[model samples]
Target: MAWLDKLKALFNFELNAPLINITKNSGNSNLGKEYVNSGEKIDILFDNLSKEKQEKLKLILKEKVEEGSKLLEEKSFGLLRELINFQRTKGEDKKVLDFFQNLIPKEDFEALESSLYLRRRFQEKRDVSKLKEDIRTRFGDRGKNISNLCTAGYFENFLMPLFNSSKEGFDNIYNVVVSRSPMAIFVHSAMGEDQITRDIKTGLEVSKKYGIKFLHIHGIGDQNIRTIKRCIYENKELFNYYDKEIFENNGIIIVELIL
Candidate 1:
């Protein structure tokens, strides 16, 4: 009976192996082929099976992929924690801490941090009345909805320009909103620089020239926080020099949203 149980577990493990492979080799060139092959094989194997059996396999695959993604995210968080340990005393450390705090369970903190980041980065004083009006009109009274709408507009107008210089501009922005309290979001353009450094430099330059404040929401994922923080801290001089207009305008604030 023990041997049978062990064999059953192994069979279940084999059934879920594709998801582990996908997570481990997400960006590999062969990933597309693997996905295609897996789907095709499943289709072929289930061709004569009952409809319920086919549906079960499909659901299983879906669940595995979702579980694998969660695992990847947890791994990423672990890496970020490791990176934080190395930069114990930097202001970036505080920023990272504040960012996570807002992201964990505090929706209000997330909203406030997001608002302050935008206000500081744009060097534009947020007219709370105007913002409130806009929020009411566009998103009603829900804080998450308001944050999503505002952040989307903010990324499109400010960050998108830095990445795409053509008069026509970028294609579209894709955003993933994580937590509300620390109000975290990730923005990506299909056409922007592959490297984060290049993207930051471009953003910094544009912000400096226009006297705009460039509010960075946070790093891509947990793994990136340390590197992103270190880069920003090390290049403080360059950031300040380019953003002199922001300084002149008194547009520097690292938001600590307490909610």
Candidate 2:
């Protein structure tokens, strides 16, 4: 009750509110978790609202849901989940999804986990050439929800900061990720781990060869660059951030080019 009370009073619409008290436990360590006081207050709030106000609020929220539906097509949701996981892995935006964990249905949670499990099993045994060929033959870039996932972390992190700190990096990211068939980047560090061993010269050469568009580097190992070479790599969960990989001596590694 106290937590929700405090949260309700925080005045979330304001942009410059001091968030210093966000971490505090509402002056009670002994109280049990208050993930929510209950939906009763929410019902009460709705009940107290004037009919006109309620209608306006419903319209506002309905519009948002409609907008979200347009954005979250099946394929986009999958890729979006991956990017969000990657961003969190880099510690970029935290606490963004904490509020929604409980809101999601239990069946949805199970289905998502099950789907990931199945995909991982398939990815582990994937043959990039054959798989790409099959994708070409079967999908041919014309499937309703198929997508291309890429990310050049070396260019984004090392080259961008050193060479064009102002806007090139941001623009490139936006074009490749936000635009270009609506693909996005920012993959697991394991995919881009070679940024350590690679020099700028090599990076430029590879970037130029690969059209400067980074494919989601599944992972790197022994001498394999997964995406450009093969394509079985690693991944984390949608929200849990679990490290799932199949990095054998001959596994995914497009992030690192062997010179």
TM-score per candidate:
0.23, 0.21
Give candidate 2's error at residue 80 in angstroms.
16
**Local distance difference test scores for all models:** 0.38, 0.34
lDDT of 1 by residue, 45-135 (tens): 3343347744665565556555553324545654455445534543432453353353334554445344434333333443344444443
Best by lDDT: 1
Find the number of clashing residue pairs for candidate 1: 12
Best by TM-score: 1
**On residues 144-168, what C-alpha lDDT tens digit does candidate 2 reach at each position?**
1122231222323433353344455
Runs off by more than 4 Å, candidate 1: 1-194, 208-211, 240-259
Output the lDDT of residue 120, model 2. 36
Q: Alpha carbon lDDT of residue 204, candidate 2?
A: 38
lDDT of 2 at 70: 37
Positional deviation of residue 179's Cα in model 1 after best superposition, in angstroms: 25
RMSD of 1: 17.9
